[model samples]
Target: MLRLLALRVLVATGFAVAPAIAADFPPRPVGQNQAGIGQDVNYRIEIAAGPSSLPTVVGPVSRIKDIATIQTARDNQLIGYGLVIGLQGSGDGLRNSPFTEQSIRAMLQNLGIAMEGGQARARNVAAVIVTATLPAFVQSGARIDVSVSSLGDATSLQGGTLVMTPLRAPDGDIYAVAQGPVFISGFSAQGQAETLTKGVPTAGRIPNGAIVERQIEARFNDDEVLTLQLRNPDFSTAIRVTDIINDYTASRFGNRTASEQDSRTILVKRPASVSAARFVAEIENLLVATDTPARVVVDERTGTIVIGQDVKIAQVAVSYGQLTVRITEQPQVVQPAPFSRGETATEPSTVIEADQSGGQVAMLDGPDLQTLVAGLNRIGVKPDGIIAILQGIKSAGALQAELVFQ
Candidate 1:
């Protein structure tokens, strides 16, 4: 009995000692696991510094519209066909790229040469399409950048020269001519049996390659009324814009209708008997505040979320869990007995594994935005994890603001 009692005491001591040893383990460092919280702030505001009001004499207050005219807010697109030459054997093969051969042949024929076989074998020339945008109010002889893309099977356009190409606008009128050396920031190299490449090889750009040949005629001062178009139309924003304009104009000229109608448009009455240019110059200097909606935008691909300041959420409980399923296939071969008239066979052995995380439901009675953010942070979840939680909450009709996912 004495021996038995001693044995029992030793067993109990061993059990307790094992747990005590484990309990004395060191704590993990805080830096071992940490995550950045919240979204980045990317908002900008611009304010004009000038007189806010001006007198109008040409039209009634109701006839005056916004100061920003449509002519100043438009751009023109130009396109042209060109040739890129002087490639290091990277130019399109004439036999494979018929268009390259045809283009070269046509160009040579125009220069008083003809090919009997209807094809030209050239290793230094490539057909390309050039494009550029002529900004509003561009003047003749101004230089503009242009993009050149090979229309053939050329491997690279590096160190190439672009022939003079006439760029045409949508109106089918030649407005610019592009001609310069192509600048390609990409390259390719060939090996005995393999090739390596970086960036785009067939596309390139020419800085200041296009010279404006014609100017688009736009007159902002000739109109008696000018229209101000809103980038984003909102009723409340429109009202605020109107009020700001009216206040500024009223101070200078009593009860001017420079701000009228919904915010979508504002009217500015040009000062009668004055040069249209001077009248336009006065109103363009006016300043107005703008507002945006309270919303949240999410890009799932990049795990990015942008939330406006006015976004809010209601009380809710959230639980996050992860499930993993793994499948492995092992192939096996079965050989028929030697001398037997049976063929060998193959089979696949499949193994499946499933794991479920130990998750706990968290109760959140968030009364404000700070509380909501804190509650979410306590779960130690990632952006993707939070996305699912937010989606669930929205489906349950708990989230207050709009949830837009892209």
Candidate 2:
């Protein structure tokens, strides 16, 4: 009896300490991932800095919109299985794709109709998968675009309407409903002689197609600080963004509120009595002077070469020459000259010419794109030859730029 009383006293002591311990730690507020409405005007930085000696050009200042966005306010993809109807006898064969027939039969049964067919053999029906992105902060009843692709052997989805399909997220919950007429980007027509096709006739898009039915709550407003994530990560660009925000915010608030987190993120502390949304808008509107790295991108398949303005080449020499070969069918028939018992014989001639210009050591000082082109033109070569020369320059450690081959 004494031991039991001791155990009961210990249990009572544990219960008494639980409330005190719980008071020390508070519950954390759950943050939702939601997108907010931004200005419709685009604030894009059309950077053509490295292409030439021209300074980095920033696009026109857009009104009421910021280029940078807060972290975690991203898009969510919702996908569904649906059926596209009204094809021109170019759909999945029931014998081949049993799933297509099964879908159609199930759809028909849902509409209070019963078909006693083993499998659907309709030539106008097709099985398709519908996909749409749910932007953060989108509420229910808002329309978004959807992309549909043929999941069966359907030739074209033109002039077809997608059946009511429920788009579900990764959590297996229905988020939005997508049902609209399919608009194919390309068309395909076939006859006995030949077939003509442009773009993808089986794939199509519907503008403002899927309706938003769920909300993604974000927690940017709850936190005392907000971070701006750059679309492209660069140390110089990140520093510039931070300085611009600090300069502007300090002028208004008399204190710097922004700090560079890393090469891609800028952390800004919300000021007293100012809303998080207002602070984010002010930071995004501030123009940043960005820098570019020297890079040379080339598409050999298209014979297109893009050289950066910062590209410099050490003193190098380039020499190019063309070689031509010719074969002439000049046959000479010599009759028995003066009938001296000589048989007629034919002689053939061949000619070859090699034109090699003397090599010259030309200095290449790439101060501007025009000067660079002029220096290369002095060698008088085609684009292919220019590519070879540039490759050689890079190999020789003369070209100071990152060469990217695409």
Candidate 3:
């Protein structure tokens, strides 16, 4: 009895001290505090309530590199015409693809072999388009992967080797040379009356197949300002990112360094005392509370629906039902009695039926996505029905969110 009384007194004292401490603490900035900015974000965090209970809520924190990227460090697309050789009778026909014959003749002539013939008709060569992406700051002699696709009517490109093809950028300047054995993820086989194929045989890839012949001159270190492009453009997210970056830079380097240029772009001034790469590395690792707009994305083709947590509806009554129609064909043939002269015939019979599901009206005062979905589900609505209802709600100006259809 004495110990219980002492515990009660200690608990009361703890409760009395909590409010005093809470009142003295300063308020954090909007996005800098927990349960701010990204209330509807996808990331989750589990709060330790007790040993047996684990409840999760949406987390707002995200790294700079995960949400944004340096604008100048982008990939360049390079494409070229090439030929795949050494295929076992599974190549483009000379009569069908005249370009193949022309390319082969030109290649031989370049190699000092004069081809003075009607056509170099070979069933072992296939014309292909070689494509690769030149990475930023790629130096000469570095290798990159290339994709090869049949440019003509070729049966298959299995067991083929790509010839030396100069890959050029959009500016028409050669950047890399691709030549390697093609690696196909598919195979083709044929027997007398049946043929079997898996995956795509005419398209293949070669890992590290292209050797960089020329380097792209990118003076990244010389730039004084670096542009950060957000992967998903949003005004709230951009402002949050700028504030977080400025707060970090000001405390560490003694001045603000980041500013929001637009919803999709943020300009960060590189510090003169630090290298550009090091400064970017530091900025990219900093965490910020990201924000996303409330949206409902629906894919009609796949019957997929994604509802953001911040989505709300303004006191609407939704009524939903389904109409199903089924058609079945059943036929019975009549036979002649005692094998008499009568032609065999089939009778056509089809049964069609229609059903209408009972409609239910549900009043939804959705303050969040979960409540809205639960109310819709309570009315026994399918995904297609829910999509139609969402569209109707948007048209009626009842849904307080953007409705996106894909």
Candidate 4:
């Protein structure tokens, strides 16, 4: 009987089945060692035919909608002042945060309840600022998320309820109304000696907490031309986007309708035969490959290095090494012998040593990313050493990319 040898390979997505291998040699007897088999015998290996066990390749193309957005359709920011109540003695102190007390008195007066002349003293209320974003095309009565942050010295906002607050845009118009139970993911606990806290207890968010009260008019359908702004501005990417849009429009609509306005903007003329909304819906779904400038970013604090794909290094020589010095101190007590005048003293003994690793110069000339990494590895350079070497190469004008330090 023939024997079969199987091997398994693991991939990130999952495990793929490998073809089996057949050997011509017969199976060994039970409890027999491999050394018992004749060494002179030759075994033929065969693999059963099957599908390839390689992972699928993904291209760099992305939908135009992802890389660009309509200029007129953008979010509007809204802000308002509010109060959070129903706290378990973790609210702001009236003495330290006077705004909380004043807000409480004002709210009471508005509710037809008159407060005495004395100040309101309570540890269950906190002054807060409410913020929310009004999305484009949102109509009245649509709910959006809102965030609440303590405007006073409050310890926590957990299990607190925000009062009714009107959100106002920069144009001095109320856009939404937010009022809901504040949900915080953080908590705090204190004993006599120590306190423990997790996450941010002073800030919280409410999902679908704000209802839109007013709508900002966005004349999207009446536009004669559409402007697509690139998220990352690059000349090559802009040109590619223009070319792809024109190519698509010409092929489908029988006319070119796209032009490059600048390195960051592309203008597309809406055809009379097609509506503006339909034209944008069809163009934004097209796929285009993006391009970016070659750059190398280094973070010295974390010793991180990121190299772009188009980065290249000219012919250069690099050498890296580290020198370490160590010092140790030992003290010895000395005592005077017996009778006359006994005295004790301490003598300090010190030892010092230095170590320097050998560094060999490696010639590096990379026309691609893989070759550059291999050259750096051949020099036995670590991340820190690589950063220094890259900086040196940039200073020498041997690196053909932008070097950014963070």
Q: Best-fitting candidate, measured by lDDT? A: 4
Ranking by lDDT: 4, 3, 2, 1
Per-candidate TM-scores read: 0.69, 0.74, 0.76, 0.79
Candidate 2 at 141: error in angstroms?
Answer: 1.0
**Clash pairs, model 2 backbone:** 32-217, 32-218, 33-217, 35-136, 35-137
By summed lDDT, the worst window of 10 consecutive residues in model 4 runs over 43-52
TM-score (C-alpha, index-matched) for candidate 4: 0.79
Query: Mind giving the per-residue lDDT tens digits that candidate 2 earns over 1-406?
Result: 0000001111342321111100111222223212213433222222222212234544333221244567534576677889998887988888888889888878888998999846556889889989888786677889999999998888899999898999876555677899989999899999999999999999999899888776665555655656577776767676666666667777898777776656676767778778877777766666665556778898888888898766777777766555555555666776777858888887766565555553555667676667888898877777887888899889989888899999
Question: What residue pairs clash in candidate 4, if any at all?
Answer: none
Error of 4 at 215 (Å): 0.5
lDDT for each candidate structure: 0.67, 0.70, 0.79, 0.80
Better of 2 and 3 by TM-score: 3
- lDDT for model 2 comes to 0.70
Q: After superposition, how far is residue 267 of candidate 4 from its true place, in Å?
A: 0.8
- For candidate 4, the per-residue lDDT at 378 reads 93
Candidate 3 lDDT over 370-390, as tens digits, reads 789888888787788889999
Model 1 regions more than 4 Å off: 1-73, 112-118, 189-195, 260-263, 273-287, 328-352, 363-375
The candidate scoring highest on TM-score is 4
Prediction-by-prediction clash tally: 11, 5, 0, 0
